[model samples]
Target: MTETLTTALIEMREDDVLAAVRAATEAGTSPAGIIAGLQAGMKTIGDKYEAGEYFLSELIMSAEIFKRALAELGLDQSAAGTGTRGTVILGTVHTDIHDIGKNIVASVLSANGFKVVDLGVDVPAQRFLDAARENDARVIGLSCLLTTAFPAMRETIATFAAAGLRDQVSIIIGGGPVNADLALQLGADGAGISAQEAVILAAKAVEGGVA
Candidate 1:
């Protein structure tokens, strides 16, 4: 059942994924197990995207399919549950309305036991800070597909500094235009090239292991 779920997701078969998830649940598969299967599938999708075997549309499709499967399993994609390992505040910087990558990262993080407080796209710097403080989030994920949004990302990080919460949280940046060098220049702790990497980085942040 798990294999079916994973295979359906990796193949981007939305209907198959939903069916597999339902069957898995009825077969007594735990929600965590189902989520784990989906995560493994999403990891494959991310790898394919990075390898050029897939495109943006494919990535978006995979995210959508994953969301459907999660919904079938009765999992809340918006926020983490009681067993959440940690809390993360995620959003695209102001002026950047892109959120496909952000949504992928949010789903994967939630699957990995992190509570995600997704602020949605085109989010202002202050909103990010406010959500972080309100959720007591230890990790912040700033995403921007536009190079012009870099300043917004910088401003968001600066807001954290201004609020004196810089040392209390780990900030990670993502999106097409963001790289390790850019993240450093923007005062972020690190950068993730894919949603899988984001989940790993967020987990490290929760452990206070990210520099």
Candidate 2:
């Protein structure tokens, strides 16, 4: 886990957990060990945010650092054949450039050994479907920060259903404007308040079996 983190951190140097992942992986740490470290770090960051010790800008910076570290580790390939890891398609809905939460979720999922295919911000419903098809992802995560873009989230899920892929993957959603009730209404499998919580929800979705 430590090794996984080291590699992940190296790839996602800008984000908090990803860089830590690289540091831990380089030391030959196990995947589980790396995840534990990331969970701790994410919790710390969340606590800081709750206490007003940090702001959205700081959170965004941290997420960037984590993202770079994950890229450095080539986590997409490393996650394969790892029993606890699985592939996920993640994106922020169209017309919304805010990706702080999406980026954080991607980093945490990557650190936890999940292969995350992040479709960056302002992603269209078609692109989300394309990514899911390309990756054969079992999980689909949507992030929407703007209230106006909220409908895009549902459209993405509906697109999956239209393509006959909805039942094949578990859809999870979050971000500034997302709520559990809304997500459920949109047909998502679950919702999370933070990226760490998203990772946990994704894991549960995976464990319960996608589909």
Candidate number of the best TM-score: 1
Candidate 2 structure lDDT: 0.70
Stretches off by above 4 angstroms in model 2 are 1-84
Best by lDDT: 1
lDDT of model 2, residue 40: 50
After superposition, the stretches of candidate 1 with alpha carbons farther than 4 Å from their true spots are: 43-58, 78-85, 95-114, 145-148, 194-196
Per-residue alpha-carbon lDDT of model 1 for 132-165, expressed as tens digits?
Answer: 8898888999999999999999999999999999
Give the range where candidate 1 is weakest over 10 consecutive residues by summed lDDT.
75-84
Residue pairs with colliding backbones in model 1 are: none
Whole-model Cα lDDT per candidate? 0.83, 0.70
Q: Give the TM-score comparing model 2 with the true structure, all chains together.
A: 0.66
- How many clashes (backbone atoms < 3 Å, residues ≥3 apart in a chain or on different chains) does model 2 have? 41
